[model samples]
Target: MKVSFLVSLFMLSSVQATLWGQDLITLDSLRLQLAKAPLAEKSSLYEQLAWEYRKSQPDSTIFYSDQSINLITREGLDRNIAKALNFKGVGFHYKGDNVKAFELFTSARDEALEHSDSLQYAHSVNNLGRIHLNQGDFFKAYGHYYKALAAFKKVGDIEGVAYAYKSLSELYQSQNNLSKALEMSQKTLKIRSKVGDIDGQISILVELATIYELMENYNRAFDYYLQAKMKAESIDDAIGIARINLGISQLYSVQGMNEEALSYADRALNTAATSGNENLTNQVRLQLAKALLSNGELTKAKNYLSKVVAKTAITRELPIEMDAYYYLSEISKQLGDLRDSYENFIMYTRLKEALVNAEAARRIERYEGRLEIEKKERENELLRANEAKNQALIERQRFQNIALIAVIVVIGVLLVSAWYIGSKRKQVNLKLQVKNRQIAAQAEEINSQNEQINVQNQSLQKRNRQLADLNNEKDTLMSIVAHDLKSPFNRVSAIAELFNITNLTEEQRTYVGLLRQICENGVGLIQDLLDVNAFEDQSRKLHKVKINLMDLFTNEVRAFYTEAQAKGLDVQIDVSELLYIHTDSSYLKRILDNLLSNAIKFSTAGKKVVLSAVEEEESILIRIKDEGPGFSDLDKTQLFKKFTTLSAQPTGGESSNGLGLAIVKKLIDIMGGEIILMSEQGKGSEFILRFPITNVAPVSAGSQ
Candidate 1:
């Protein structure tokens, strides 16, 4: 379950230094040289001594840096004094005295600028960028980083340039700009690799891996981590090894490999402890806590998280501290300590928001976006310039070719002037002959195509007439069948009425009633068929006339009143506004009659059926609504189709052959009106008919 990672901690330790000092040398050797060396060289030796102890013994580092500064200042070595001051700042910065560190860094920057020491000035501003980053001042950090980078590049300080790039990478990473962070890290890596800065190379490798991890390029991230580990191992950098282990552990955890994550996490903690870097140890511990959390070992996870939380309280690593608080909250929740969970969660959110202020992140993104747009614009300009250059080249090449051809043609033309004239005449005559033949062939083809088209047209016309005749015959046959069917239904109705008046038993009277209902349904279905056949004929003509809509509503209601009264139903008319419609009166009446019959036929006792009409600028509207079991969704889709059996049946045990709505819709189509059914199950049904004013009203009937 465990995998070893020797990821380079060289870069990480440099970041923690914030204010880097002179190159590393053994403290004893430097102190020994200090005793033997003269005053002039002793300052340099003291500075070297300070650099060695800056990590482990910050107080001693500060003392040695002071000695160097004192000796150098008296000797008028202002540049060296500035360097020493920056070294002193690094000591204080390591000792967690940022305010004092800031003061010393500012002093060092001024001294370096006075001496025109570009390298030292760059270093000072670079350290300032780190301080701003730690303080969550992204604006100041980005500005300082830019200034440092410019200074370093101007002075051709390659190592200084690397440091600036590293600082920028960290800033971009914090802002979640993974691509930019990786780009900067790669630049640092390339520079350090060229200069044989193993520590710097290792650090950049780890940084590259982290950027890839954030981008979810796990395979690449893993590859980079492995490379960093190998490089750290070759250098035997224990801190680098510890960091690399921690990175791999996190990578595994991200992939949900809890067992392997926990294994690497434990190894990382042990390695970090051995490396004697408390920050590294604490970071590894935090990672271990997360692994345990993922594995559902809440109690153990909480124990590890508590340590990180307490350490961060003093160290003030907000990102780590925030994470620790979140895990603690989750553990508390799992343990059923809801109050503790809520408190922990609140702290976690406060720390998180404070560390990564939303407004700051947005500003960072906006600045980056603007930078990207400007970069693209510059690229486009370059591309346009290149295109112009290419066009010039092409134009020169084209003119050369044209001039060369003209010269050759002039020389050749003189030799055969007479032959050229004769050949030109031959070409013109040949072209004319070919063109004439092409026109003649095209004319012939057109004639043949026209003759074929005429034959096809005649055949199509004959088939169309035959179809029309067939439709007429079909319509006549349907009408005849319906008429014949209507007579039998009428005879059945008459026999049922006769039986009803006979001295029959109660069962016999019930049978007679059933017979009469059956006859009525049959007769109604036959009439519906006749109407549907007539309405479906596309050639059927409508006799347009102006009619009062109110009068039409009144007549339709009167015709359905008897059936409505038999069921104790009220037929009401809405004569809110009398309107005229210029449409076929017979077609409109038939449409109204079928809709009214359906309304009363399905309605229960003691219900109402309303007939209403209203006029608008463009249309006349009519509605027949009944209080009955309404149509279901499935029914409405096919309600106007032939023979659609719907969910809602007649409430009065009335028969429905499902042709009423179809007939109404067809008749409305013939009159150039539209009908819509509005109904819901368990509510009621309403049929709305709309006739366009252009068709419904040829002329306005003055309002009465």
Candidate 2:
């Protein structure tokens, strides 16, 4: 067999070399030569031929795909570029070079995004996701699948959406999420039917049949299999026919119909052979072996299983090969060949463990690669945006230069004309000269005013430049803050999830708890950051309405109940509902949310917090007090100032980022209200928020 393989490789290489001599045909020539040919002509004469040759000479596919990319990229044809990239990635994948495949898919995705081609973007995402899925990184694969689904939905691409849905369903099915798998498959079927996608419909039918088989509903599963077979026959799809036969063989085997199962397996093998798909042929052979084992044909089963294992090994599909060994071990045991069974079982376990470890390592590598790619793309986008802004600034400067030149020319002409007029006036009589002098003096006064105006304009321009710089800095800071905060919290949540999956030491468990608390505080800090950024944007509107102070206080207190529980604190609300003031619910909510959150953050654990609202003549006031360590004198002096860093710490040793009071002050000012702080060194602080009353009269008895 080894000698035969060497000879075959030699013959294939010779054939490829012979064909390489005639490959000078350009794409244009191919197009012109096949102008009147059928749709299959391109695949048959070009893509298929190239792909077949790539089996013996993989470098040839890289060469052709690179040529394709170069030609299309030079023409600025983004769609063709993405298509070339997809082909390249698929070629690399077929060659068992997943790293290269991932790189090509990422490039394709970037190009697709650049063109705003969501369908192509989704295709790239799906391809990348498949790589991760095959590597067993289920979490990363899920992320990619969801991203593809979202992109496909954005462009209303029903076919793409169906494919994504089906892929996700398969992933979930593999992970034993049967309910979600069935739901996703149903959705895929609906979409395929809606779009008249017969191929997709058949694929979904197969998935549904598999699900039914998993549930041990043999009758229903067989019914679905028959329907899929009919659909395949209608379309004359050889691959689908082979797959259906394989499914039927499994159903028969599970039902203990040995004869029928063997016959169906034989049919599946014949169909796979006719289709000339090695993968399908190998799969059907495994089914045939399983059927033989069930029929008590131990010798036949051993022979078939050996063939299956050898074929899978030659194909580098070690995982499937390992399964074949395990099945052989079971068959040997049933036949009372203990020695053979033990040997095969040992080999199967060793191979399975090795494959599992390799797959885990592959997953880690893939995730790291994806993250690196994402970071690079982010940097590239930032660079491109900055370049655009610089170009715009340069363009503006150019325009300003032109305007300045024009203004200088106009001023010079005006000065020359004035000189001519003054000289002419000097040559006239004394009385006329005196009037001309007065007119010239008025002209000088206007010139002085114009100079002063230009000076002020320059000063304003300088200030505007400074503001623009500050705004740009703020944008950069916000981007950093937004990106940094989410991921840490995500990591914390992920760590907490591991607790449910594995046993941990007491110290480790406590550490995880502390991590969760820190993450929650981080979330609070993020909310404050977002609020501060919104406040700085200067475009927020305050909603104003009449509100009963007591009702507002009660609502705010209720909102904080869960938060108080987490800290083991008690919250009390004391207020009257009859008193009312005018304010927007959103603004009031913001003020109350910030104050309560700060109170919770600053107070000691297991303390009591009280909220009170009351009316004092015309003004309505609400106050929140906590029984915890109060603020120092230094904190009170600069409490509400922007960017003020407070030294006060919570009794739990939690540090504050100090933007809460600034946001509260902004909200209060927007509502035409005020907040006052009163604190003793040892007692907790009290925040009193006051708002003016509105002119809404209550229902009168006379009216009733």
Candidate 3:
């Protein structure tokens, strides 16, 4: 029975290896083709390379993605740009930068939506759902996944639908809803089978197997795992094979087949390492550790577990880390290292508790976010109701006024006719005089009504003027408040800077850092407030002058160099030595400063920020590009709105008062420059400022 069981497990594991087919082109083949390909073909090749390398070589994926992006930009291939961005985001996702991945997916989705490309849109949305699912935002994940399903269905995209179903299954499985996960996986399998997608079918089978495993249906799970492994092997998918081996190893370990588990674990580890996938290798190592520990190989198990633990710390895979710690504890206890065993146990317990607490906190945070969204929706509903009510009141008053005027005109016309008739009939009868007297009396009453109407109109005009004055007063008060607040904020910032320069104990330095951060945030908010007031002030005007573009860019770069360097960013400026433009020096400087600051603030360490300028015949074009988290579709709509923050947070923990871009836009407009934004969320963003050269003669050097 034991021999038969081990054989069945090995067969099942072998079948799992064929889930994903090998890439059509090898790395060398792709590189050779890329070298001689046409511009468009080269771009396509780069994108293909990015997709192929995303799983096993993330850095290479990013490099190829950048190559594709550069080519797409040169060719103005808007559609291909979205694909490159999506692939780049996939690279980030695999590299464990979920936030960056989410941003890139968002950007791709936006680009797809903009182009009305339903298939790409669905793909990006599905990816977004996966990100949210991994982040433990179940509601958000569900929302995006359903949206993706709808989009895919609308486009008649069978593949996209299957992908969405698979994602939904994984999400449900993560939530421990095995029944729903099984249902989703089965649906996905049905679709994939109908479409003759063997690879997709294999993936769904593995998912179903996992769900069954979680439910403790060992027989069913084993059966599905065998089917998946066979499908994977049929397609020659090395990664899929390794995944299956790992799964089988875990299953056998669970069944107390230590020797068989060890065999499969070693196979999986070797395959994963060969495939150059650190994530898979770590997973396989954990399984191997468990198998070895069960087989009484304490030292080998400890080594494997320790390596997994170290990698887990970097990957932030909490569950894997916890498992590694637990196993290490067991290994230590068996080796008579009681002290080490207790320490490992404590570490395991702490990590487990932290994971549980984090999950609970995330759930609470999500609930609160939902409540806030609901409250905003309610507020909007009320505002709409109030607007309707006000409109109705205005319409009613307008009709009433018109009716009053019509009645007055009729009364006047009748009185005039009566007077005329009475005058003509005066020669025919004595009663004519009495009628004239009544007409005269009516004319006097009409005159009195006219005076009253004029008085009411004057009163309305005065009230309108009063309302205008009140509005002005409100703006003035806000301006005063902002101006008054700015001084103290500046003082606090200056004081903090001075204090930061002095040495202190570690705890005191931390407190000083906090104080500095608070002061800086306050200063940023006040500056934004002041900018808002200035932007609304009609009296404020641009102070245009002949300025050197290179000088301005260099100064801004210098100002931001410390911050960027601290975060390990490379800020490069590529501009002509004497590039000059006629613009408002202060306003233009502000624009550059804000953009550079934002670029540095949002970018992760080891990324590059480039500032380049080109002199056109009629305008100076300046571009600032940063490899930071990009903006979402929703973010773009409100990008220049006062106090509007986007989904992405600054990597450096800088304060985003949401005023920087708004002010930059306003300043650009003041200088009569056109500002364009090009960004894909995960990749980075580029801000292009085109300032038209004025017809006025350049100021003399002496004027400076």
Candidate 4:
């Protein structure tokens, strides 16, 4: 028994050494290794070795795979080639030559279909669709995914079907078709659960969280993210864990809690690095840079972002490179490096446009190819009909000539006519064959042209998408600018007239007071606008300082104390003085001032407005509740939108510019924070804001 165990151990060690060896060794080595491996493990081993080989030496990977494919293409070996082809395509894909990869995948898929290898076919289709998706050819990706879904279903490949649904969900989500994204993701989750695929379920959870986040439903997003994180941890999947951390960091960054964001980013970066996932590493690095920048850690942010930019160039990661440049633009503007900002921004936009245009060009080319195919079929049908008609006419002429002649002559004419008809038929057939050859040649040429056209279409589509995104961003900027300019203009005009008037009566004096009040409001609006624009443009640098929330609240409440007193209102505070936060002083000041001012303006006479804060898990929640007529139904929906407003009269009948909340929203977005309002018909309204307490310890800082 001991001797037998020793022999088994020796064999296992040999297998492990071959599998985990740093080198490809040799084909002989692979063959020997394969001979030792169980049939079930042989294909997977080849796939792994091929992928690893592809990184530094794709030719060698292909050589090995091609040898495998040929060996397997013999009798009862078609299934083997399908697997080999799948690996070959993956190798090509990894080399960033998706066109060749897609072709190979299609070939594999076709072979799989011929052999009725449903699993291989499904996998091939999935890989092909993923390539299309990566190219931003979403429609083609969707078609491929659906085909994969059908194939998987036919084979009862639940895991395959679930994977297809997940991909489909991502495609729809990119299109902003949220309902469909939700539906497909849910289906994917269900299927994965049914199959007991924990890892698959985790992926779906991440997607679901993203969908919820896009819908501005943070609670749902948070729940899904946590669920995904737990599952990832349970599975010990480093990549999944890294991804969940990245998602968590993003959520925190969006809420302007830079410290927590950085913590999450740090975790992601470590996991991704350890896992040796270059894609996740790049992504995590970018996120860390963004988080640092948002948190006002400029030096660290710049260092990280520059590293990401360099890494992007090295890796040729266009999407990540674009993001890096965008972040650089923001950083440069904050540092008051206008020229650098402008250049980086332009580069970022151009790359984005180029990608969108590429996708569009691909779509147009596909459509044009379809039309050309239809035309060819029509032409072929017409040529065949013409040939048939000519043959019939020749036959009739021969019959008539034979009938009109003497018996022998008629017979001779008949034979001659028959010979002529046969010769004519042969000539017609030859012509038809030549025409067919020409058509086939033309078809081949057309296909090649169509491929080129498809590439151009993809280019155009990418550009189009980029333009649309830019246009949306531009609109947001313009709205804020317009609202800001209008307020200042109104104040300037009012001030000029008030000064121009000489003989002012008591009533006129009252009017002047109101005008001054409006002007003051305008000035405040101008400040908010300037702050938001400066931050977005990166013209204003951030200073990170720790803050105590209670002290911060005290100062804000004090600043508005005069107004509250005049309105016969009592301000109630429910925050813990010991609770601390860390963020940019100016940004936090602006956010709180806006929220508080809006609350004060809407509060009724002699009403109590409550301000409170509480810590939940890793987040800080602040609530401002007012006992006043709440937002109207319409206002509740459009509160933060620029221009659209309830135009509600303040307690003192003062006119509101409606820029406060808009500015609040912009500032919050810049700070990476979230703000939400809960309002009833007349009872009261509550605004809840959440931020994160980051890694840095809190230190007292002066209020803005």
Residues 215-281, candidate 3, lDDT per residue (tens digit)? 9898898899889889889987778878988888888888899998999889888788887666678
Candidate 2 positional error at 325, Å: 3.3
* Candidate with more favorable, higher lDDT: 3 or 4: 3
Candidate 2 residue spans exceeding 4 A from truth: 1-64, 73-80, 93-156, 170-176, 194-196, 215-220, 252-260, 273-279, 309-317, 371-704
Candidate 2, number of clashes: 2
Candidate 2: global Cα-lDDT? 0.76
> Higher-TM-score candidate among 1 and 3?
3
lDDT of 2 by residue, 524-633 (tens): 77877877777666676665665666667777878888878878888888876566666678877888888887788777767888888777767777888987678789
lDDT of each prediction vs. the true structure? Answer: 0.81, 0.76, 0.81, 0.76
Q: Weakest 10 consecutive residues, lDDT, candidate 4?
A: 12-21
Cα-based TM-score, every candidate: 0.42, 0.46, 0.43, 0.42
Off by over 4 Å in 1: 1-25, 53-59, 92-110, 128-144, 273-279, 297-704
Model 1 lDDT vs. the true structure? 0.81
Cα RMSD of all models vs. native, in order, equals 24.3, 30.3, 35.3, 38.2
Taking all chains together, the TM-score of candidate 3 against the true structure is: 0.43
- At residue 621, what lDDT does model 2 achieve? 76
Q: List ranges where model 4 is wrong by over 4 Å.
A: 1-64, 75-144, 270-282, 309-322, 325-329, 335-704
Better of 1 and 2 by TM-score: 2
Winner by TM-score: 2
Give one digit per residue, the lDDT tens place, for model 1 in 537-633.
Answer: 6776878877887788888878777778888999998865446777888978888888888788788898888888877767877888988899888
